[model samples]
Structure formats: structure tokens, C-alpha cells
Target: MYKNINIFTDGSCISNPGPGGYAAILQYYQYEKIFSQGFFYTTNNRMELMAAIIALESLKENCNIIITTDSKYLKEGITKWIINWQHSKWLCSNKKPVKNIDLWKRLNITLTNHNIHWIWVKGHTGHIYNEKCDKLARYAATNPTYNDIGYI
Candidate 1:
């Protein structure tokens, strides 16, 4: 039997607002691949969002994807409570503006074109793909020489 496509993504930054990177890995039975990008100046949240977006974008149109990430932001925003925010024009509970609205909007649009299942996994528990994603993200953060791939 053919298994479902599985993807895991992660992002890391040296500081809350510092050099950052995002990584994503996709697997389907016998096939697997990884994608990652880094930025010289960014936040962990941005990278996290980027990782998910990148992973989803890598899939063929309309293909169902089961995406796993450690980010409550991605899981909750996409699965739990994004509609309310969208209806409210991207404002938060305090009526304050949401951060990274651009990326959020892009991710939302990308998701609409594909069947995606957002999943949450505990971080740093020795899960092979999860750990690999973390390593890829950290490596990109540490290596600032890499060019930035902004908001794609």
C-alpha cells in the first residue's frame, strides 16, 4: 500500500532577533528529500513559517500532504484559529497587528491550493527527520554566507 506523504520543518535563530534559518524534509515511503534556507537577519517565527511554506510549495498541486512541525504557531494558526484572524483582517486578540502578515498570507494562499494536514511533534526527542531539520536550520543560521530567500 502507498503511504501518505510526510513532511517535517523547523527554524532556528541564534537570538530571538538574529540570524535565522529554516529547514524542511519530505518523505514518502522509499523516497525522501530535504530543503533549507538561511537569512542574515530574522526571527525564529519567520523562519518557522517559511519552512512550512517551502515544504508545502514543494508538493505538486492538489497533492495531500501531512506536515509535521514543532511550531505551535503553524499548527494553531493553520488548523485551530486562522479563520478568525483572517476575518478580523489579521489582528490579534489585543487588536494589535499580527507579525509577519506577509508570510502568513502567502502560507494561507499556498495551503488553499493543496490538501495539507498540519501536525505537531515534540522537539529534540531524537526523531530522525525532526532532528535532521533542526540541524539543517542551525547550520544555516551559523553560516551567514548563504543568501537569503525572503518570503517564498
Candidate 2:
């Protein structure tokens, strides 16, 4: 038997280099789980990348994971561009530095063990799981008490 799953992820930052949060929701069969966290200082892109990395890391092994995200940068990086980026030592088209190289590296390592299908979705379009993740991430970034409530 195989377990097919869909995961939605997003991240929020109050300001660039400010408070940040990341969230991911995983759905498998009849079970679902939400993971979220807050950081004292970060950026939205970082959170977006982190959510994807965290979700992939949570997978046990060899699972089919369809990762839905709103960030085009993330979807493109993980699904289309990471291979070339890795080959080029993480340089951009202009041969300039790649932003968030650390997170990209982490995401690459975490994703190596799973079969992940990256999907891009429009943000704030009322997708249930995606909305949930966004809400969690925003709340985490704003509310100190709620920071990193469920994510380990």
C-alpha cells in the first residue's frame, strides 16, 4: 500500500530582517498535521524556504509528497532551478550571489530522501490547508506566546 499526500506551506515576516514565522500542513489519508514557528528576525523568503524544508524533513522516508507553495521563487528553486544552482555553486543568472543560499542548501539536503512534487498555488485564494498555514504563520510572527507552538 502507498500513502499519497498533499502538503501546503507558507511563511510570513513582519519586516525584512524582522520577526518571522513559517508554517506547513500535511495531509495523508484521514490524518492531518500543522507545523509552525516564529523567529525573532528573518525575511519572508527565508520563511517560505524554511516551511518547505521543514515539511520535507518531517517525512519519514520514500513518501510521495506534493508540496504546494505560494512562492514562485521556492517552487522554481526546488522544482526547476536547484539542480542548476547546485551545479553553478548557487550563483544566479548574472553570476551574482544567490540569496538564501543556506536555506537552499538545507532544503536540498532535507529533500534528498523523499519524492517531492512542488506545486505553485495562488496566495490568499481560500485554499483550506494553504490558508491555515498562512494564518498560523502570521499569528506566530505577531504573537510571542504562540511562537513555534507546534513545530519541533
Candidate 3:
């Protein structure tokens, strides 16, 4: 039997290259774990990716996970687009180096440790956990600055 985990993640940014934040909610059995972080300088995409990465990295052992995100870039990029990027040495179709290669690499490594099913949900809706994640992310983004992780 496999232990199933449900996760919801969100990201927020005041400006494209300004303060940003990410949040992740993990639900397993009857327990829930919440993770949120703020970045002094970051983008929504990076935060979105960070949300998922943080959730996966928090795990101590292999499990089956359902990861939900509001960003299609987060879902489709990891599941659909990354294969080609990996084959092309992290290059996009135009052969430009893929952005956020570091985070993507970290995510890829974390992914190898578990079985993940990606799902995309509409943002700003009334979904309980999704809304909670969004609130946490927005709060982190608008709040005080934190140590920058130097996302590229």
C-alpha cells in the first residue's frame, strides 16, 4: 500500500523582479503541514517553483504525492516541457538556456525521491487549501524582506 499525500502550493510577487513569496500545504492522513517563505528579490515563476520544491524537499521518505498548483508553468513545465529541456542541455526550443535551471535541477532531484501527480487548479477561487496557500503567499510577498536566495 502507498501512503498518499495531498499538497497545494501558491506564489505571489509584488513586481516581476521584486519581493516574492511561496507557500505549500501538505495533507497526509489527518495531519497538515504548511510551509511559506519570502524572498527579497524574486519572480512569481521562481516562487511558484519554489513552493513545490519546498514541499517535496520536506519529505523524509518516498511516498505518493498529489501536488496541486495554480500555475500551468509549474505543472506543464515539470511534467511536459522539462524532458526536452533536459535532452537539449536545459535549452528551450530557441536554444536559449532555460531559466531557473538551478531550481529546476533541485526540483528534478527531489522528484526522483517520490511519485508525484501534478494537478492545476484555478487561482482566487473558493477552494479551501488553495485559498489558504494564496493568502499565505501574498502575505509573505507583501511583508518584510528576508534573506535572498539569489534566484536567477
Candidate 4:
């Protein structure tokens, strides 16, 4: 039987490509786990992808998961654009290389281990989990601890 998990994630960047952070809250019934990490340099989009990727990667076994995020880039990319991008050898419609390919690949591999549903919520909209994640992410971005190797 698959364990059911709900995840809330958010990412923040001090500037477009400056200090960044990602946060994820995982809830399994009455138990919850929070994860957050800061990177010295990264884009907001990369941080967003990292939030979801880290959350999914934390699971120890195949399970049913619902991932909620405030990033349309992440939600639409995974749910709507990934297949085509993969089929096209990771090229975007404009024939440019896809950005954040490393994180995207990580997310794809992690995804194969479970059944997942992606959800998108507007940021700063008073959604409880979303707001908490946003606060965590913002705090992390301002207090970065590591460099984002992929962004360097």
C-alpha cells in the first residue's frame, strides 16, 4: 500500500540570480517534517525546482504524493511541459537549451518513484501552508549557508 503524503513548497531569491533558498513541508497524517536550505547564489526558478525536488527525494519509498507550490514555472513545467522537452532532447520551443536542466532532471528521476499530483497556489494569498513555506524560504534566502554549484 502506498503511503499518502502532502507537501507544501516555496522558494525565494534576494535578487533575480542572487542568494536564494527553498523550503518544503511534508505532512503524513498527523506527523510533519520541514526542510529548508539556502544557497549563496541561484535563480528563483532553480530554487523553486529545488524545493519540490528535495521534498520528493526525501521520501524513503514509493508513495502517493500531492505537491503544492506557488511557482507556475514549476507546476506548468512538470505537469505540462516535461514530456515534450524530454522528447525534444531538452530543447525549448524556441530551440534554446532549457534552463535549470540539472534540477529538472533530478525532479524527473525522483518522480518515477511515486504517484504525484502537482498543485499551484497564488503566493502570499493567506493559504496556511503556503504562507509558512514562503516565510521559511525568505528567511533561508537571507541567511544562505552554501553555494549553488549548478548556478556557478
Best by lDDT: 4
Model 2, 20-49: lDDT tens digits are 888999898889888888887778898899
User: 79-146 in candidate 4: lDDT tens per residue?
Assistant: 98999999999999999988888888999999986999988999998999999999999999999998
Considering TM-score, where higher is better, how would the candidates rank from best to worst?
4, 3, 1, 2
* Candidates, ranked, lDDT: 4, 3, 1, 2
Task: Give the Å shift of residue 64 in candidate 3.
Answer: 0.6
Between 3 and 4, whose lDDT is larger? 4
Residue 12 accuracy (lDDT) in model 4: 95
Looking at model 3, residue 82 earns an lDDT score of: 91
How high is the lDDT of residue 57 in model 2? 82
Report the lDDT of model 3 for residue 40. Answer: 84
Q: Whole-model lDDT for model 2 versus the true structure? A: 0.82
Please list the C-alpha lDDT of all candidates, in the order they appear.
0.84, 0.82, 0.91, 0.92
lDDT of 4 at 53: 89
Model 2 segments beyond 4 Å from truth? Answer: 144-152
Largest TM-score belongs to which candidate? 4
Query: Clash pairs of candidate 2?
Result: none
Candidate 1 lDDT tens digits, 1-152: 22467889999998878888999998888898888887888889988998988887777646678898998988888786678889889998899877888888888988775667778889999888889999999998887665654543
lDDT of 4 at 77: 96
Give the clashing residue pairs of candidate 1, or none: none
